[model samples]
Target chain A: MRHQTALNPREGDVLPPFEKTLTPVDLMAYGAATWDWYACHYNDAAARDLGLSAPFVDGQMWGAWFARQLRAYCGPQAFVGGMKLRYHAMCFAGDHVECRAVITSVSPLADGTEIEVSQQIEKAGTRVASCISVVILPATGVAETDSEHSAGKATEEGIRT
Target chain B: MSDLLSDEIRALIGAERYYPAHEEIGGAAIRYFAIAVGDTDPIYVDDAAARRQGYSGRIAPPTFVVETGQYAGNTPSANGYIPHEWPWPKGFRTIRGGQDYVFKRPIVPSDRISVRYRLESVEAKSSRDGRGQLLAVSLAEYLDAAGAIVATNRELFFLQPLEAGQ
Candidate 1:
């Protein structure tokens, strides 16, 4: 198993930002995958009708990317407690979106740690969306089993991890 | 022009609308979603890997439920499409403003899921460019075949009128 990320993130700690340039293909695939099929994500004419520059990325895609990053950072053992996003601006296809995170607070539980992270997605240096993610980190000795093991332990132990 | 925030629309607050139909989670859809999100998690695609992780079978990415039957599912209407679900002003364009998600369990292929939604709140707001519109907040809950709540989402949508000129 790969070394897990140390759960010792400090308040005001900044995680390395994730960067990606979204493409039309990415948008199209996401639309199909999510069954969104919304015109603003696909048809250029439809976007123009909406007075948009071009087909834009779905906001849910932003949430998905956030979830992926959290899973990767917290490792498979961590239970994502909750996530909240505030969309501030639009990100069009072909726009470079960068996701950045900062640890807002960390609270230790009986079996693990609960971390709150403030995150944001920026397009060309402009804030497109801001998010808050709360995750329950497994206890230090707990082997990272996919959630089942840890969740049961969480309930039995009253740790809420 | 009719006010977008009509009394009837405001009355919808706290009214729960249940999408009476259920859709089975399919492996193909899960795989496609995994690909779309650029998530290479084997547990999302490989049954063996998923089983090893103690899941019943191949499980889906945490965010996968956000799309489960969102646009393609049974509705009260015969066509299966819920028109004007957004409750925005007539001809005003609506866009996703934000979302909050909480997951209790992983949704696996063949799991039958149902959805229920309610308008949580509606507030009048202006964009940075100074266009006035309504921001609607709604909550949707996903339930499994056994009627256990698996996930929930609080979604925010921005309703913009065309005359505002972007």
Candidate 2:
């Protein structure tokens, strides 16, 4: 299915902020789904035993949250080319994690507009993680995945290599 | 190098691993993942709702590939990718440092998915918790049955050794 609206991001455009107060139930569900049953994400007592104040959320889960925000802003058609992230502080269950993203640059390609978006997760005013996403907004009148005419069809190797 | 992170682990860098067969993106897996991530999007669970959006049927979230395509290792799943054991130093534990994902298309239920991974790089470092250790990196790729690349995930892992002989 297609989302009727398409997200046309301009340089310096900041998307709306999304927030969630992660609960234990949320953590448990994520653990069961992802097969990451690490104690640090589910057992508070185990976490304290390991010297942590409380059980924290999975690092990948944070990435997923950011993806959700970007997908909502860019619409369903835009491809999430890649994300680069660094973990700084731990985000525990019950902590409020605010997710935000801003377009840093817009490079026009033959097939679409490749935008660099910077994202982050902050808890209580302190940054918990920093991320950058490369999203390709297909040009108007361009066919999806038509490599011949699409702009900036940067492959995965382009991002890491 | 610490006795824990031996040269053997470093040699693993540049290795390419592939799963034996492709697995289907079944509905149950998508449902479990949607509930786990706390995502309330109807398109992930309700086919009728997803149909409204134009999908042929219920579609999996972009990240669902992580679990369904995970390498099963010696404990490989009956119908999943072959498990590629993490190449950390013996006796050393590992922690996730970061992750990156590139999605070519959204995965829908009934789609057959195949997975492969390459050990991209390995580096030696020291963290507050250890005198000397290793930071390993790997990239996993997900492909559809037609051979189209669907997604790529890059993961960073920190490995630290334990004191000799427990």
Best by TM-score: 1
- Candidate 1 regions with alpha-carbon error over 4 angstroms: A140-161, B1-3, B70-84, B87-89, B129-131, B164-166
Please, what are the lDDT tens digits per residue for candidate 2 over residues B26-134?
7888888877765666767888766654567778876777644333434433322133546454576556688877877778878777778898988888778657877
Which residue pairs in model 2 clash with each other?
Answer: A1-B53, A1-B54, A1-B55, A110-A151, A111-A150, A111-A151, B73-B83
Clashes of each: 0, 7
Q: Compared with the real two-chain complex, what DockQ does model 2 have?
A: 0.21
Chain A (alone) TM-scores for all candidate structures: 0.83, 0.82
lDDT of 2: 0.69
lDDT of model 1 at position A69: 68
TM-score of each: 0.83, 0.78
lDDT of 1 by residue, A1-161 (tens): 43433466678976555678888989888877876666677778878877888988878788877777676566555677788988888888778888877889999999889999998889878999888999887676434544322222222122110
Docking class of 2: incorrect
Question: What's the residue-level lDDT of A22 in candidate 1?
Answer: 81
